[model samples]
Target: LAKTTQPISMDSYEGQEVNITCSHNNIATNDYITWYQQFPSQGPRFIIQGYKTKVTNEVASLFIPADRKSSTLSLPRVSLSDTAVYYCLVGEVGDMRFGAGTRLTVKP
Candidate 1:
């Protein structure tokens, strides 16, 4: 499993763009970067994923550089309801480990 490093907390205003970056210095070539968003009392949901370069979905975007040592999760036009924890994971299927996540607070 690849260890991930991310901020403990972040803040953003309504309608603002929020970017949370995760570092995985020891990622393997077969690993993929996956991001998940979790609201209070709810399970974490998948946001975006990429092996290299960028992948965008209706909810968020994931950016991975050529080296794939790090990734960024970009959330556009966030609202108060978007306040939650964000997790960055690097692994192949069935080899992921969930650790502490980045807490995002979206204010009005």
Candidate 2:
């Protein structure tokens, strides 16, 4: 199993873009990769997910390098409402492991 590493926290202002990155070493070839966003006292919500190249949605974009050892979650034009803890997950369906997560504080 791979272990992931991420920053403890990050700060950004409203209307700014934020990028949170996670690094997973010794990742398996079949491991599923994804990102989640969690607000205080709330369960994590799916944000963006992918295992190769890049995947984009209305809310955010997920970028993975060719080696698949790391990924970055990019949030465009974030607002105060986007303040939350973002986690990077890797593994099989029922065995996914989440990183410590990056706490994003979107200030006004």
- Top-lDDT candidate index: 1
lDDT of 1: 0.90
Number of clashing residue pairs, candidate 2: 0
Which residue pairs in candidate 2 have backbone atoms (N, alpha carbon, C) closer than 3 angstroms, thus clashing?
none
Best by TM-score: 1
What's the count of clashing pairs in each model shown? 0, 0
Off by over 4 Å in 1: none
Give TM-scores for every candidate, taking all chains together and pairing residue i with residue i: 0.95, 0.94
Lowest-scoring 10 consecutive residues by lDDT in candidate 1?
92-101
lDDT per residue (tens digit) for residues 1-108 in model 1: 689999999999999999999999999988889898888899989888899999998999888989888999999999999999999998975777766889999999
- C-alpha lDDT of residue 62 in model 1: 89
